[model samples]
Target: MNSNRLPLFTRADNFVKDLTLTSNQLLLIVCAYIALILNLPFLFKSANAITGLDDFNWLFLITFPIFLFSITLLIQSLFAVKWLIKPILIITVIISTLMFYATLTYGIVFDYGMVQNTVESDSAELLSYLNLYAVVFFIVFAVIPAVLICSIKISYQPFLKELFNRITLFAGATLITVLIGTIFYSNYASVGRNNKDLIDYITPYKGIDSIYKFARKHYFYPPLKFQLLDTSPQIINKNNNKHVTVFVLGETARAQNFSLNGYNRLTNRYTANQDVISFTNISSCGTATAVSVPCMFSRLNKSNYDKRLATSQQNVIDIVHLAGTDVLWISNNNGSCKGVCTRVNTQQIATTKSNPLCDGEYCYDEALLQPLREKLHKLEYDNTLIVLHMIGSHGPTYFKRYPSNKILFTPDCQRSDIQNCTQEQLVNSYDNSIAYTDYVLNQIIIELSRLSETEDVASSMLYVSDHGESLGEKGMYLHGLPYAFAPQEQTHVPMIFWASAQVSNSTPDIDLTCLKNKSTNVFSHDMVFDAVLSITSVKSKTHHIKNDPFYGCKSASFVPLPLLESAKKIQTQSSGEH
Candidate 1:
């Protein structure tokens, strides 16, 4: 190998053979390549976010790129070993290309929560995110560069010389970072503190950081034993009639889109006259199903919600099962339950290809109803709690969520790359999905009502979404941004409840009028644990009256809207805010 250029054979052996590069040169090239090409989304976002002005400005032009490049250079210098740099750079580029596509298209960040979601997602979910556009993007951005990188055969310096060069390079990079940072302290401080997610936008590095964080927590950390929260919970309002409660866990259905929450369209037409109380102002624990589903079921509130901690401890499902209520989880949303249903009986309908409503890829929410009816007919326990996890409006393929005949909205986007579609088309598809979810929920309500009348069971139902989604609002798409800086479109979700005449309006029996009066009042997933316990009549030590929203809305008396807002304001102002 010549010092200026060397011919090293590649597996394919197609590219220019002679590559004149040293390990130090390769390191600099890799760092520069990632900082400039792979970090375009991050750089562009930072540029826009930093500049309050409409046009491109000078301060941001000078400050961010140099600082970010210096940081990348320093990080790359740490791994500048002769044999290690190529593979490392190749891997970084490949993974970051996908991340870059996601961030540029949907404004997603590879935060810890997103990493967890990615690792937990099933094949169907994974395939949904892939398309021709994504393939082309990856090929242009990742594969070609990786192939070129693989072809590079570098010259090496003497061991002592290499070590000294690396030390000097590292020191120089560090000094450059410090100097630029000091020069742009005000600009950096303003953006960094106000936009904590600015750090998350750093491509490949943030993705790498998230992967390490998730792995360390899941694999390397000390595992905690499965906690049994309440083996013997207090069952209230025991009566001759059986207690049947259906908790429908919704997926990605936001409150603002539902007609029940004053959407201009009748997206919630099916449930409009079903005598259900829609909770208008409801916040989710997290912006993704992986976090929200488990967190809602767990004893932890959103403020203290940790996936590992929440999963290790027994959730509401476990408590419900222990209270002698036969617990059944009917899942149409694969991977959305996030192990919350592992302790209980579960039936998968996500890929029930035999079902007419379902293809091999996914099933409609109606797939849950038949099994539920069968379970109702063959009821073994008087007190039963059934969780129907619906794949409601989950995107970027919302068009596939419902059957063709159920498509109430026209001009719906049929493609997976929703960014290519008009806002109207995208929303039409999403609205149809939401409407279909409501139709399914209405079916459940009707079935439960019939059971209450014919089989003499005290029945009720609650449908609450795991999280909301952004429909191109403020140049964002989908959910699973970091919760700290996530928009309301990804955090505020829909929650609704319905009770049959069999459920008397009294203590332990929630009053509809009272619940309606507090419909506009604020609530969060923090209240779901105790609310579920209360609804299922499973009263454990953790099921406090303060945490059960229904328990407070037992009276049929109505509070004025002004008073409700004032109360909400007070509640939000003080401690223990959601």
Candidate 2:
């Protein structure tokens, strides 16, 4: 060959000869394809629940054109660069990096961070956006180069020629992919869900009004003008010795694991000593704070919560207000749901200190007492209702749930990420947070007791968890499961009440001993309204007298265990049993 041709031929031969693809590159491609396949099923699943807004401005629409263009460019680049494996891999890296960042950021933004306060009905829309961006961006900017690099790595021919051939082949594939996606979207556009269906499935006739009310409460700039249903509310037993009920809402505390409920561990050493009623079987209404907090506070039942959400006449707080008691809601959790305490006097401890325990400006549950004490001191009146919402055992940041000094376990006082530690370590960190909670409650009780003594006021403290947390059970890390399918851990939480001497004196015959030894297996957050009413003797017009489940209305239902049948034999010889 001529010298000029020799140089070109030799370079081509070297490029093709040296070209090879590694397991990592092939694996990446396979993974990307798998992701695409997986997304298709997800898209189909979410399609049924699509809203009109989704149909109109789906991410697939915008990404289709870019996807086509990207695939075309990638094909062309592949055949042009004979030894472009590194360049293509670099492109893939860029695309994957962008996707990784997008996914990570998406989790953060929704996890605890806020957006423009715009609500999207389907979370899949955001995921779809990310998927579309990844597909099109990779096809356009990364594919051809990646194919060229593979060619160089795998072939023994001229780099440029190999790149060209590979690009030509892959470009065809790229076009086919884009064409398929576009055609699918185009044809399915008219078939997707619409506004009427959204109204039907999510907000029915009765629910529409409620949905509108919820929207007004959370998103409506100018609030909706609505009147309280009961204008002439009658108070029951007006003379209850200036009753004060403090409901301390604990976060993510499981009842079964609590030592107060006979758990193997000493998790409830401090609470066990207190003069309190530990309702053993108390279950949360929902698994997520967003759903549970709102549902628990709202004057709605399981059957009507969705429908009544928007139009519920009043919440528990509002009921307290109408009953002539000062209502206060102090919280540390993210405002994911509607501000349940919006109408009530609200204080947020999470946003108070500069350096708080968790990610946000949220301090531990103990911080609630700081403002709570002040609020109590400021209150000149004897009748008041204070709701202390604790940022209890919210994980996977169990270590941050409590203070560093409160760590009871030795060797490691606390850990921000329990997953990074052993199972024992994680348990220790979690239990420590619970221990701190015990201390916080003790302090609140002490303060309340002191107040009753000093000012001659009557007070009672009621503690109920919004929901329980799961600690490495069945591959689930946190709460947010649908209530119907949630495990026992997510539902069962510690419910206790520590009353002041004056208040407990009135209910002198109240039995708290059985509460310590046995399980009140039928209790739920739903009974909260009636329980509060019964304890305070506050009667409201809406208080359903007959169906009120908390008023000595224990269900005569029990789960049968064959293993317990052996108790007959064991009991016969259990005269000396401890």
In the range 1-578, model 1's lDDT, one tens digit per residue, is 44335444542363535666777777788788889878988888788777854444486567678778789888887776778888888887888888889999899999999999889888899899899999999999999889878887888789998898888888988998998788767777777776677788898888889999899989998866766655677566635468889999999999999999899999888889988889998899999988999989877778777777777777888987887889999998877579899888988885757779898889888899999999888888878999999989999999989999899999999999999999999999999999999899999999998998898788999999999999999889999999999999999999999998777643356766776888887889988987787677766665645556777655322222343344344334322321
The number of the candidate with the highest lDDT is 1
Candidate 2, 1-578: lDDT as tens digits? 56466677677767765756542334335334423331232233334433333344455544533443344344334433434445544544454334333322221111111121214212322232334445664565346445544455433446566546555556666676667567666534553423222211110112224445556655765443443533444334334456567888888888876777787877767767777777886777776665666667654544445423333346656766776777777776554325567677787655534645543445677777777888878884446888888777766566667777777864442443333466678678778778778888888888888888987677878888878876666544455544545678787878887766666344321233433444455667766765665455455544433323333422111112342333233222222221
Residue-level error in angstroms, candidate 2, position 418: 3.5
Pairs clashing in candidate 1? 4-20, 5-20
Mark the 10 consecutive residues where model 2 has the least summed lDDT: 107-116
Off by over 4 Å in 2: 1-229, 237-240, 307-312, 334-337, 350-360, 410-417, 507-519, 545-578
- Per-candidate clashes, comma-separated: 2, 25
Assess the local accuracy of residue 470 in candidate 2 as a C-alpha lDDT between 0 and 100.
65
| lDDT over C-alpha atoms for residue 390 of model 1 | 90
